[model samples]
Target: MSKNSIQIFDTTLRDGEQVPGCKLNTEQKLRIAKQLDLLGVDVIEAGFPMSSPGDFKSVEAISKLVKNATVCALTRANKKDIEVAAKALKHAKKPRIHTGIGTSDSHIIHKFNTTREKVIERAIEAVSYAKTFVDDVEFYAEDAGRTDNDFLAKVCEAVIEAGATVLNIPDTTGYCLPNEYGAKIKYLVDHVKGIENVIISCHCHNDLGMATANAIAGIQNGARQIECTINGIGERAGNTALEEVVMILKQHSNMNLDTNVNTKLLNYTSQLVQQSMGMYVQPNKAIVGENAFAHSSGIHQDGVIKNRETYEIINPEDVGVSKSSIILTARSGRAALAYRAKNVGYDLTKIELDVLYPEFLKYADTQKEVNDQDLHQLLSSKDNFKKSVNF
Candidate 1:
């Protein structure tokens, strides 16, 4: 991988589908796998094969279908889970088995009723066992966000020595701030022996609404891969949004990082996942949201109309949005009103616009943003214009 190239590891089918009521069937998972491939994600975490027979088949089917991206299966750090995942990915063009155990003290003592040493042993053994099935093995230190950095570095070193090709440092509970997360990844890079030979991947949750921020910080600190989901759908609040991270890198060339993601497919991919998972992307959500490119404030609408760069850092077409929307609300100005009018087949002169502006405002106050149909009604009605004072 190039030093500035970031790998987009999409966990939508595995982590995203784990949301309650969002579980996808085998065929549905396959459909999303195909889309993720088309979107140029570097790795597709297809499913947790050991979770269910349905999931096993879904992973197996996706493995057979995906031709470009590496098809990966998630598993616990154990023989049974690893074996099942390997078997499911048997036919993949490029296959990976992602297996790991929790590294945080809370997960070790309470969740597993084990000691730190025992957790390390399990992680090493799991990665070594997985390496036997496939040359590509990723070891995740679950809940590493809260794990002691020194101990986390130790675990990462042991796994890399044990033949792990990728080391995933996950903020599994979304517990770390951006600075903390970046420091954690930087510590691993500096302290973990043989770290340069393997990829450092970040998997972050959004409990505090900082998953994307944390992931970016990870890359800035040397992590090379981001594990994210389409539409940010995942457990709890959600995972890091794929579109958010990709566009961030694209927009801020100063970051000096780029991903394989074909950004034009981002909107379509988000929509497909939203529909498949029965989840809605909030209007103000970043990147692929409905309002991401819509300008409504008078100042914003005018700036966007004159030059999109004034208000928009990203072009609507860059992410497959047909065009930037200049919504005509009561807050909109004459410039936006005239822009919309021309689109719907009317060209209002400045004098004519001044005449229609107040009536447009009166009608817009009664509703949300004025749509083309509403504008037509306001423009074509002689009675409505009759009330307007001549300008």
Candidate 2:
């Protein structure tokens, strides 16, 4: 991989499916997994093989089906989970076992009921065991967002020494600010021994809606791989969105960071996941949302009609969208009205537009949106509008 290239590790099939009511059958999982591989993701976290028989089958099937991307299976820091994950991934051209234990004090004491020393031992044991099965092993310090930097550095160094090829520092609870998360990654980069040999990965959650920011910060500091999901689907609020981070890196070329993702397939992949999982993306959601390219406000519409870059940072076609939508609402201006009017074959002159503007506003005010049919009716309903029509 190039120094500036970021590895996109998509866990959509696993973490994304964790959302309540977003479950997918094996067939659906296969469909989405194929799309993800085609979308140029570096790794696909197929599923947690030990979670259930169905998940194991899905992971096994995906391992065989995926040709290019490394098929990864998630596991806790244990031999049994690592064994199951390895069995499921035996057919993969390139397989990865992702295993780790929680390192945060909250998780160590409250969740694992263990001391930090024991937690580090389990982390090392899991990575070493996983290494025996797959050459590419990723160790995650679960809830590393809150893990002490000194202790987190120790865990990372131990895993790297234990043959872990990747270290995933996850903001499991989505609690860190971007600066803090970046500093944590920097601390690991500076403090951990032999860290230069393995890739640093970021796995941030969206409980506080800062997952994207935190993931960006991680990469800026030292992380190379970003674990994300399509449409940001996951447990609780969700994980960092795949599309958002991909586009952010692309748009900010000064950062000198890019990903393998095919920029155009973002919307199509998002729709595929949404349909397969039946999870609805909010209209205003970033990147692949319905309104991402839609212009509704009058000032915005006018600016966009003149030049798309005036209001849109991204071209609609770049992400598989056909065109930008110039939605006509009461807030729409004369320029937007004339632009929409021209699309429906009106081609109204300035004088004609002036005459029709009041009537259009009257109709637009009564309705949420004024479409082509509405404009046709509005123009034909009155003799004055009929006279004003260029036709």
Candidate 3:
């Protein structure tokens, strides 16, 4: 587990709160922080302390409460911001001052209106300054996805030399495809000095809906940590989902990466964030979505009844999701009718189920979803009629 460990750096408090109309207060942040710790995240990005006094207080309180995971404060590539961030995290059992600057030309020319050389110098200074207050410092090259690979490598190597413990390469606008992002991480893995000693981290945004894929690509190429948010909540499109990435490692690929996440806590954690943040998750979202394991189609229900493995790649209970329904609809089939019937305590024989499918379809035609009572009533009526005939 130690060798294959994948550090989960959750930024739900910082990035997630940035979503429009989803701001969370200090108490809400503290509650979420305690849960992320209990859920076993390796690091919690409490907030950007320099953003406001409220943010600073939230980070300070969260830092005081977190017992296991390192509590981190986000900062920009300036001594003032890094100092503010460092002060906010001073009470953390394990404090980290995260400081970084934009590396891509777009950010340099437009956002900061500066030169690339100046950005690199600022990055080195920020990481060095942060290191003075906290032994654990993480340096992110914002928009690294669009930065020149050679310059990105140089920036990463300089930060590592400046006492930074982690190098975060972020797909800031979610621009790069998976293959390209993987190549970027692989290049750093191969080229950066003492790169093996520093944890190579991936932070991907989901503007192209490729954040999870990009993060996974980073892992395959030697990244050991994923900087993500709960339910994929973050600025704009969002960040990689912590639960999605963790369960992907546990259930699907041979990635063999381990996170401290208890597989069963995913749904609860997701719901908590959604409610506290006032953001509703799309029903079709992955991992903790309401419909992730649900089936309503005829062919899919039949296949699933024959073998769950035919339809479901991961078990529902594995992520704290209850068994999803083969929701009765006009598209349902005999297998689904039988499956639903048995769940309500009616052990219908294949022959009995064969007869009930059409009746279930009639209900499906009118109803959005079939109820357990209605299915039982339909089956019970058929049983009574058969017994009367025998009598």
Name the candidate that leads on lDDT. Answer: 2
Could you tell me the TM-score of candidate 3? 0.94
TM-score for each of the candidates: 0.97, 0.98, 0.94
Residue pairs with clashing backbones, model 3: none
Q: Where is model 1 more than 4 Å wrong at Cα?
A: 383-391
State each model's CA lDDT, in order.
0.93, 0.94, 0.89
TM-score of candidate 1 against the unseen true structure: 0.97
| CA lDDT for candidate 1 | 0.93
Clashes of each: 0, 0, 0
How well is each residue in 284-322 modelled by candidate 1, as lDDT tens digits? 999988899998999998998889999999988999999
Per TM-score, what order, best first? 2, 1, 3
- Judge candidate 2 against the unseen true structure and give its global Cα lDDT, from 0 to 1: 0.94
Q: Best TM-score goes to which candidate?
A: 2
- Model 3: C-alpha RMSD to truth? 2.4
